[model samples]
Target: MNTNPATIRKGRKFEQVLEGARDIFLRDGFEGANVDDIARTAGVSKATLYSYFPDKRLLFIEVFRQECDRQTLAALDQIDLGAPVAEVLRQAAGHMVASFVNEFNQAVFRICVAESDRFPELGAAFYRSGPRRLHDELAGFLAGVDGQGEVAIPDAALAADQFIELCKADLYLRHLLRIDDSFAPEEIARVIDGAVATFMARYGVRT
Candidate 1:
């Protein structure tokens, strides 16, 4: 098997382009960004940008995927599935809400909502790479914890999904709507507390 150095180089350059595009998108809304700006931001010429991404829409999708994957992994990877079931659930909820509230994440989310109809694929990519994957990971964790007698649930996967939805339902909605001035530390605490309470009511180990 022969390795193509050009292909390897192109792959690396594509990664760089995604990073540059993410930064640009964060600094400037999607409508304000362009291939010329992305190429300059990536430290590549127009030729290189077009080589990896023939169109701005394709490049935007790649950038959205890269960012969504990074955030989803970072949030899910921090959970310690070995911890006590209650702790694990709390940690997952805490991490998920915190990551979602992050300025960059919120910005990306706003951009998706603002342009969802115009760029439906970007929204679809985010949903698949982010929440869908997190749900899978959480389901696995919940199933493991259920087997350990830390929680009792008829459906671990459904419980995991519900747990996250409980945590973010109110807070996430407020943030998304820009109705909240800012997230006070105490507000996060309130969300966490409410989420944990709901989780325990549904799945706590009945002693």
Candidate 2:
């Protein structure tokens, strides 16, 4: 059982490349970021960078995927499964809205939209990593809540999507278009409140 220092160093460098690539992608976006700059930022050679990512498109996809995973997990962690239906929905909607309107997320979304026509795969990857995952997670949660007879959702997946769309409403679109770059805490709360109320009205089981 001999330990290889070369293997350890390669692993360390791999992580550094990912970290540096993520920073570059966030700061410069996919179209603006370059591999040479990424290599320099990561303190790695061009050969090493390409060995890990193969191409800039793959690197951008990896960065977005990692970010989506991190943000989704962080937001879901705020939810309490045991909480009341309205309370749980409110919390979940709040997290979803906040993430959707986040400056970094908005930038990534804009990049995906702007480039998707030329790079269809990037759009698909973004949707799969971000919205699709969130939908699946929310559907699972709603299904469990329905099982408890707290809600009357016939199609948990549809309900999940509808709830998320409701949460987004005009706010996400307005933000995306630069109609308004900032959302006050009260505005966020109001949007979440409306979404939760609308969802509960449709799906809640009355006594």
Candidate 3:
């Protein structure tokens, strides 16, 4: 389809605001960030910013959605569906755990928890954008794998949730609590391998 120049320009400006708002939110947090600074950082007028996003919360949600789509959900597209099921699970679990344990993601999760009482929708918005979306994507993958007879998953969605939780294990909790700031590569690998093995033990088809 052909593009309109004005629409293209508007889209570019919208992206600029998103980038600026994300930086400000990450640096100053949801309550601390202000529209004036976001506009200034974005090199756009306050009117322009408001025209695109009427409120700070909407802008924050957009930023969060972009981050979730880019960092969390996009990884699923990289998996080779033709590969061995165990290998695919390991790769997918690795991506999920790695995304969850990162500093940026942990901060986002903390923001959701800390603000949920005041802005109850914030938590729901985050869940829909991040965890729920990831779960759905993984569920779809598992269903496809099951259809191929690679795994015997009677309930693909439940199995997806279980596998992701197994991948998180205690490491994600430790990171969230600031009890541990980092994990070794070997530790991550071990976690992914164990998660895959556990899932297979429960769901793999018999010979």
Q: What are the RMSD figures for all models against the true structure?
A: 4.6, 5.3, 4.9
For candidate 1, write residues 90-198 as lDDT tens digits.
7877888886677777787778778899778667766776678778887887777675666787898898789878888677878777788468878887888888888
The sequence of per-residue lDDT tens digits that candidate 3 reaches over residues 1-207 is 112112222455999999999889888889999889999999999999977777677787778888987886468578776799998888888788888898877787888888999887788888999889988988998888885666888899999899989989878999989999999998888888899989999999877
lDDT of 2: 0.84
Worst window of 10 by summed lDDT in candidate 3: 1-10
Off by over 4 Å in 3: 1-10
User: How far does residue 2 in candidate 2 sit from its true spot (Å)?
Assistant: 33
Cα shift from native, residue 80, model 1 (Å):
2.0
Superposition TM-score, candidate 1 onto the true structure: 0.84
TM-score, every prediction? 0.84, 0.89, 0.89
lDDT agreement with native, every candidate: 0.75, 0.84, 0.84
TM-score of 2: 0.89
Q: CA lDDT of 97 in candidate 2?
A: 90
lDDT of 1: 0.75
When 1 and 3 are scored with lDDT, the better candidate is: 3
Runs with alpha carbons beyond 4 Å of true place in candidate 2? 1-10
